[model samples]
Target: MNRAALRLSARVREVLEEAARRPDRGDISTTTVIIWVAAVTGAVLIAGTIALVIAKYNGQLNNL
Candidate 1:
């Protein structure tokens, strides 16, 4: 059991070392930023529309 634990630790260390030595190609690019912004804007617009519809319905019910 101890030997197995040591082997696992060594393998993990090796993997971490290799990952650290790799190039930096995981940055968030401009296209990703634009897409995220668009997604957020669309979500806000949809939420606003739903709220407006609900408000309108409540207003109509109150008038009755």
Candidate 2:
């Protein structure tokens, strides 16, 4: 290839490599983490409705 093409390709490769080294997007985002934690917690609560003592203890067990 020509010198100009090689130079452009090298710069583009350098930028891509630098970007790949940083893992800060999509699944690792703050909102995604919060949503994942909330979903898991909700699932646990729903699955363990009978064993959720805190919920009953906080309220009067008679409510259930």
C-alpha lDDT of all candidate models, in order: 0.92, 0.83
The residue pairs in collision within model 1 are: none
Choose the strongest candidate by lDDT: 1
Best by TM-score: 1
Worst ten in a row by lDDT for model 1: 18-27
Q: Model 1, 1-64: lDDT tens per residue?
A: 9999999999999988978898575979999999999999999999999999988899787889
Tens-digit lDDT track for model 2 on 24-44? 534477888899999999999
Judge candidate 2 against the unseen true structure and give its global Cα lDDT, from 0 to 1: 0.83
Q: CA shift at 2, candidate 2, in angstroms? A: 46
Q: Give the local distance difference test score of model 1.
A: 0.92
Off by over 4 Å in 2: 1-27, 50-64
* Stretches of model 1 off by over 4 angstroms after superposition: 1-25, 59-64
